[model samples]
Target: MLTLTEKPRRSPKNEQLNSCASSFADYEDCIVGFMDDLQLVHCGHDKKCLGCGEELAHLTLRGVLRGSVGVIGESRLAMTEKVVLLGGRVCAVKRFRQVSSGRREFGKKIEHLARVSQKCEYLVPVAAYLYAKRIKQHGHTALDWNQRLTIIVQIARGIGFIHEQYPPYEKKMQMNVHGNIKVCNVMVNTDFSACLSGYGFTQLAEPVEVLNTGQLMKSPCRQQENTTYSDELSQKSDIYNFGVILLDILAGPKGLEMTKGVKEKKASMKLEGGLEFFEFYVKEGKERRQVSKVLEIALACISTKPDARPSIEEICFNIVEIL
Candidate 1:
């Protein structure tokens, strides 16, 4: 038995942490889980690290991962949307193109990657993955107010869980979190529940100096020539994206186009009390109040300043309160 009284820190590359994971399959329904890097995290965190158990998918399992969750910088893997297996079980698959790691090494990496993020129910579990390849939601706004609201809450909890976990190994200093959270990428399962997909896949788009009101750029304090790629990948940027999608759900596509210069703090206060801006429909004051709570969340998520955005944990907590 090990006798160190202190907490277990991330073990060095040469040493593997104790394996605590069983399997990645959540067989209850059609819902998949949150997409994240296969990175290991210390178990002490709110979401324990996924254990290093049977997470490997061999070339033999090829064609299984027709679609992948997301990809890293050059880790560039091929991707598809989804595939239905022999048993009527549909799965998301991702195949990698340029991965140079051998079989055993690749398995080790996947096993270590998710040991910390396996516990969140909001995150759909991976039944299996085949490395033979390489590599990764929206649209839930049309249902009744209750269904729409439930999806919004589920999404908030999923992203919140992601943000609560530490930034992945390569992202700690660069500070990338979720980086991508839009509507088309939000997956709805057999039960009609929602879970965020396409997480952590940082965009390689050019640094944008100006963004639409719907996609607010982080407020800049320094007068710099341009924002770098790393600068645009923070949690605040993700919040802005989430806000845009939320607006899309409430107001539809064309509505957000006119949101040119709405003031954040002022607009938020008005929205929480009423849905005057979006023309939403709710049966009673209580129902309206509950839905408006989400409107407030969208505003906070899209705050102009990075420092002004609420942490994911706060957003999740607020969503839970509304329920």
Candidate 2:
């Protein structure tokens, strides 16, 4: 199992060590101390490692990760995020919000995901799980076109594997659904591949009754029920969320906001205006046509009727073909 070394001794002349520090400050101090103890230098402000100017950003933990002893990075999620030292390697930790019950079940699910991640390159590699009262936030931004496409395809393959129940071994597990599929939940590894997060959190939400036809039924009393049901945690709902991610990729941050407005307007007008939105952003030529094709796929995925959407396998196939 992964273990941490003892904390590095502080310098006798450095008087700043006596001041009170926040948990995040303490974590940073620990990292700086460890680096100093090992006689390492900073590659830049974000990373430090042994040897002159060697990049340590790509490092991954080698063994089973232990919880909460030697944390190096921290970020907020549904609850909190942390990076910990394990066997001289670094790994990320995600801590969920505390609830009244089902802590055991939550841990089991995370353990299962960690095992699954070892076998699939697409899912985020989880090393350890932890429970805590509070933690700090970390920021991650989206990638460019080529990088985004690569990650999107990888995510599609990961979701496809879950839906197919195809584990690495011969034994088949139950078909799984990635109820959350959004840009925020997609993490970029050191190599720039996509790793999906927040898989099991969907279970924490209230369950919706599904129709026998595998479609989400609307509640009788609410007028906005259709919109609400369309956004529920389900296989089809995942596809819709993925479609939004696609739009985010095709359109940059600013363009995505415009497309969202177009989408809402299209919903109100009850028109299948289709790929015309691409014309505003994409040049009218081969590039536009290619984008239009991708937009078509995205449109189908986000169809108002869940039954109208393609299966995860089909979506993967289409994305692969596009790539």
RMSD of each: 15.2, 13.3
Q: Please provide, for model 2 over 1-323, each residue's C-alpha lDDT reduced to its tens digit, 9 standing for 90 to 100.
A: 11122234456687434421112232343344343223222123235332123355544332212223323221111322343444344334333222322535444554565556556666654442322111001121333345556767887887776666544322121337776566656666556666676564445333334332201111111111222223465778888877766665665333344655655665432233234453233444544445555666776777778899999888877767666
Candidate 1 on 1-323: residue-level lDDT in tens? 00011122344776553432112222112123534322322222233212223222321232232222222111112223234434334344433333344545444444333343356666544332222211012233446677677767777777777666654443222223666565544556546577664454332122223322211111111111121112366777777777766666666554355354334444563545444455456556767777667766776766667788888778777878877
Model 1 regions lying over 4 Å from their true place? 1-78, 84-91, 96-109, 128-141, 166-176, 203-231, 261-276
Pairs with backbone N, CA or C atoms under 3 Å apart (clashes), candidate 2? 73-83, 75-138, 76-137
For residue 284, model 2's alpha carbon misses the true position, in angstroms, by 6.8
- TM-scores, in order shown? 0.55, 0.55
Winning candidate number (lDDT): 2
